[model samples]
Target: MKKTLTVLIAAGALLGAAGCSATPQLTNEETCARVKTVVSAQSATSDKAGMTRVANQLRPIKAAASEDLRDPLQTIIEYFDEAAKPTPDTAKLEDMKADYSAAGQTYGQVCGTGQ
Candidate 1:
């Protein structure tokens, strides 16, 4: 759980992700902007609750995101979902960090962020 909040905050801070079910297909720029807006508006509080919320919020964005963003968003969602579990598997969490980092880098590239 210690690592959960850390990764959550890192992902949120770096990517600032989200989208809605009602959202239409978005251009890459629009998707990036929407993600930043959604995440900034709802800052995570507790580890489990926050990670779960983040995962839930990101699913729709993944569905509507540009092709370049789909894989990264899916990876991020998987990270958050694993972190939100009551007893996150340490080995899994350890293995996931590299992928999460890669996803964050992908997000930054796609969104044109320095992060």
Candidate 2:
């Protein structure tokens, strides 16, 4: 009886360990689908408040991006963050735009869409 109980406990421990293993990572396609949803919500609004809203919307895209697109999405987020600032510097904004555009072009090459 003791031997049988020991075997049952070991089996239970193995089952629990298996259940606690890390979740399966998202595929590039799955990550892109989630990114698309967040990107679609972005608008071309120039006002600080509007840009702030867009930045908030874009926050999730960074988290959902695949490895290939992560840096580009991060750059885009930084652009939005800068644009949302109350007193954004024009020169800095231009620099950020260049970075954002370059990253966007890279993303386009990979994802087939710049927007």
Summed backbone clashes in each candidate are 0, 0
Could you estimate the TM-score for every candidate?
0.74, 0.64
Per-candidate Cα lDDT values, in order, are 0.83, 0.74
List clashing residue pairs in candidate 1: none
TM-score for candidate 2, please give it: 0.64
Q: After superposition, how far is residue 4 of candidate 2 from its true place, in Å?
A: 17
lDDT tens per residue, model 2, 1-115: 9999999999999999999885555556775676566556646466777667666775665565677877877888788788788777879889788889888787777776745
lDDT leader:
1
Model 1, runs deviating above 4 Å: 1-24
lDDT of 1 at 70: 86
Error of 1 at 32 (Å): 0.5
* Cα-based lDDT at residue 101, candidate 1: 97
Q: Tell me the TM-score of model 1.
A: 0.74
lDDT of 2: 0.74
Query: Model 2, residue 80: what's the lDDT?
Result: 79
**lDDT (C-alpha) at residue 20 in model 2:** 80
